[model samples]
Target: MGSLIFFTVSASAPMTVLAGGVVTTYAVTGSIGVPLSFPILGVALALFTVGYAAMTRYVENAGAFYAYIALGLSRAWGVAGSAVAIVAYNTIQIGLYGLFGWAFSGFAAAHWQADLPWWACALGVWAIVGLLGLFNVDLSAKVLGFFLIAEIIAVLLFDIGGFGHPAGGSVSTESLAPGSLFTSGVGGVFAFGIAAFVGFESAAVYSGEVKDPRRTVARATYVAVAITSVLYAVSAWALASASGKDGLAAGPADPFGMIGQWFGTGLSTAANVLFLTSVFAALLSFHMVVSRYTFAAGQEGVLPRFTAATWRRTGSPVAGSLLQSLAGVVTFAIFAMLGRDPLLELFTWLSYVAAVGVLVLMIGTSVSVLGYFARRDSVESVWQRIIAPGLAAIALIAITATVVVNADSILGAEKGSVLTYVLPGIVAAAVVIGLLWGYTIKLTRPSVYAGIGEGGARQAAALAGIEDLLAQDERIPA
Candidate 1:
């Protein structure tokens, strides 16, 4: 649970937001409500978790969104959801490679005066991540935990520095006001705030590797959410307080710049350093998530079984890890050959897809939660199994709609750009294909189809042609 919480928090990449997202949201919305939305979105996720955490108890595979969707919706939807999830996870993970390549190269160029290409930096970390991905998940978790603590400390220290010396010589409560979120660009605020919470849901993906998954998953998930929420809000609030009225307008253009100018060179340097590690942390977090999704999909016979096979000693998904690593190499090469701007093209497109994809996954999971318990009454109260998830589903649906309506604003694209329509269209198509794929499974393979969300146990049994044994009484009646 501790390690999972670390991975979850690292995935949030608090410093990255403080340095970029918070200021960007402030700049876009022209409203200080960006900080407030953290808590609002956190609450929505909390309600969503009420059902999500419960569903984890019964889901067979720790496929995270895929398992839940398969069990709650249908096996086909699970497969489709798995496709969308793999795309989404890869989308974000790939984008991070772009960001990582760009940031690291830029850093080396500026400080060390090394004229290296961004792709080189990208492939370098790709090697590190790919190598690490092949090992035990616990190792990754420990590294993430260290990065999480260091980054958090860096942000907190900066916050203290900001509070110590206000940007405009006086603190302002305008940002903390509730009405501020209802202002001009609240939808954009909702859109971006939700994006920051992307990898928090992925803790459940590690269920198969964790101890006492039911309790561990729940504990890590809730704590990850709570800590991510508070850290973002507090850090943003402090930064806003330091920036005051004037700096608020200038904040977005150069967030770290404002910090350096306000705080000092030393802390600013630290923030910059932490900024790189935070993004790296995010990269690894997403890498683990993407690989796990691929691993689970492979296990379900949706993909080649070899890809989902685990390393006996480390308990890591070796095949999926290698495949993801190979994909990263090919992608980085494509970007390099094309000579494209990593951040503007690769990161921009992929990040948008990932952010929206996670929202879509949650919407599916919310409904799946309701479906999971409704068909059976052997569980807890109606509130937990039914009403809570139902409310969550509705809330997520609304959130998804808000984001879609405000997509152009959020992506900073022209009102009806081809890019704008295409990104979302991809996910919608994936869902449709997934639904059909599932229905086909129902027709062709009854046994595997029947084991869709039973924790992969039934599916494994079915694949071994022992599904009948799974249902047979094992009692040695004497």
Candidate 2:
């Protein structure tokens, strides 16, 4: 349970979210109401988990969204969901390299007077992540746990300092007002707020690896959501309290540096160092997630059988890890060679795309939960089966629509830029390809298709079928 929550919350990258995401969101949307979005998003997610956690008791697969959607909806949509998930997870993982490189390079130049290219620093972290992915997953979890704790401590200290020294010698709750989110640029606030919780839903992805899947997954999911929500909301409000909403909108050159003045250079330097670790931890966590998803798809025959290969000694997904490493190398090389702005193009654009992909999956998963329980006659309550998921579906629909409508602001682009269509089109293409591939498999491979979403149940069913066929053949004297 501890490591599960660690891996899940580490995906949110606490230090990075505070230093980069929250600060930029303030500047971009000019909405101090950003603090209000976290709780709102949290409520929707809690409703989502009401059904999601219940569904996990019945299905156990690493490709959680794929399995849930497949079982509840159809095998074809499951494949499609998995395809988009691969794209989303990979983009978020690889995209962090840009931020990692940019932050590390800047820190090196400033602190040590040593110059380094962002790509060079990025590749250094990339190599380390690739190496770690080959080892046991427990090792990766430990690493994430260490970094997550350190970053959270640093963020809490910063928040305390910010509150200790309020802008006008008194605390302000202007940002925490629910009505703040209803104003202009509300979509941008929701978009950025939800993006901060990117890794919370990842708890169920590790269901197959945990000790007690039923309790551990549910508990971890709820705890991760609660931790991130309280931390982000408090930190955002603290920053506003320290800098004031008006000053934050004026856009200080460096929010961290500004807040650092309230304390001293020592804490400021520590925050910068932890910021690098935060990004690396998120990179490793997402790498594990993507690899596991690939592994599950292979086990279920959605992808090539070779992808299911795992190291016997450590239970690490070998082929899947290598695939993710190759993806990271290729993406980094492309951005490096093109001489593009690493922060703006790589991190910002890819993060936005990942956010959109996740929102789409959440919507699908919420509806699939309803579809799943509707077909079952279990002892679960009506809220778990229907009410929660129904309301979740509606909330998610509204949230996703709002985010998509204001994509221009989220991406920091002109209103009619080609990216508004092209970036999202990437996810759209994955969905289409998945649907077509799933249909092809159903037509050509009936045996493999029979176990699409049955998870462990599918293997038992196949073995039983084989025994029955053998018995019938023997009785015929063949």
Candidate 3:
């Protein structure tokens, strides 16, 4: 069931919409080389997954970052990781809310002549998602699955049509050359690539709820990563080819707009619908991610206990879901009051912030993986422990650095560069707060500290057993 939720949410229509948005970003930044970047990033991320998957077998929890940190580092790190997860997923979710509202409002205004504000649509959708989240998890999964299938089919149709009618002469070899690869620079490609795999970690988070978590989680993680990579590679290639090398470089009015011209009105409408569905799906997926992180934190006593409460019958994290949904409502309300355009302003700004948070968390996870293996002195080969993690850390750091350097261009900032620093700064603050919290708990509650690695409920039980044994030993003293 957890795996189903992961797939439904991750592969939903919103992912496709996100894919289009990501592709557009790449095309603008990476140009004709955008297609190649996906594969390269995919391969590098898979390398990170090597140790990532290896670590999962040893630690299990619904909160992905929290669980990973607990196993490799400390409970403080786990708490901090959950904080980052909440910020990251919520940023993405809220950003998409802006995009969804803006897009749907435009759709309504143009198609139905309705003058309703974008926030009106955004709030309505938020209500629906919140209600759905309150119900059984399976229902959410089913809705996501339905949307995902339709979105995938529509995307495939666009791919076939684009490839069938190449915009330029047959596919060019120049797109594969080194010039194209470095045109956007390694930094640009890394940032864009990271977006594609942001949700891949959802697989690990579902371990507790999945049927055979050990196998299912690992398989799903790898499978989702592979499928997502291929889809990006193919769609990007087709999109670039459809626009032609020169045309692509020149930046057509709408790269995707050309699809409507080539495929005709029927297919164009289908593409738009798919894009909208993709946005919705992304919103749902991120919501699930944020709620689970909150639930995990509560379970571990890192957050308010109320968030840990689950619906007994459904075994769903009801309080956590409502909390996250409430956050979404607040965010929407703020943007609405500011009278900001959801698609152009809110979506662009918050999504970039979320991306930065995720990258920071990834860096932390990579370091923890290396540390865990180093301490264990496990017989696993050096590459898994040393090389892969080392390389991944370097790559992630480099990507983070590049984002910092090009923060203006990436964030679409005017003269002010302050917004560019906000993301990394936010992540750093979270980590520092986590470290402090961890120290406090360690000094005041040694028992909880000892059980941090074991996780919440299990850790408490283990501590009780230890106390019982000690009491018996004292009683029997002679």
lDDT of 1 by residue, 25-98 (tens): 67655677677889888888988887787776676555468778887877788888887888888877887788
lDDT of each: 0.75, 0.80, 0.67
* Lowest lDDT 10-residue stretch of candidate 2: 469-478
Ranking by TM-score: 2, 1, 3
lDDT of 2 by residue, 314-342 (tens): 87999899999999889988999999877
Q: lDDT tens digits, residues 320-423, model 3? A: 88988988989889989998756545776676667677888878788888988878866557876778877887877776787656655545564347765675
Better of 1 and 2 by lDDT: 2
Q: TM-score per candidate, in order?
A: 0.86, 0.88, 0.83
Question: Which one wins on TM-score?
Answer: 2
**Candidate 2 residue runs with Cα over 4 Å from true position:** 1-7, 136-143, 168-172, 178-180, 205-216, 250-255, 309-315, 456-478
Give the clash count for model 2.
0
Pairs in steric clash, model 3: 13-278, 14-278, 14-279, 14-282
The alpha-carbon deviation from the true structure for residue 102 of candidate 3, after best TM-score superposition, in angstroms, is 2.5
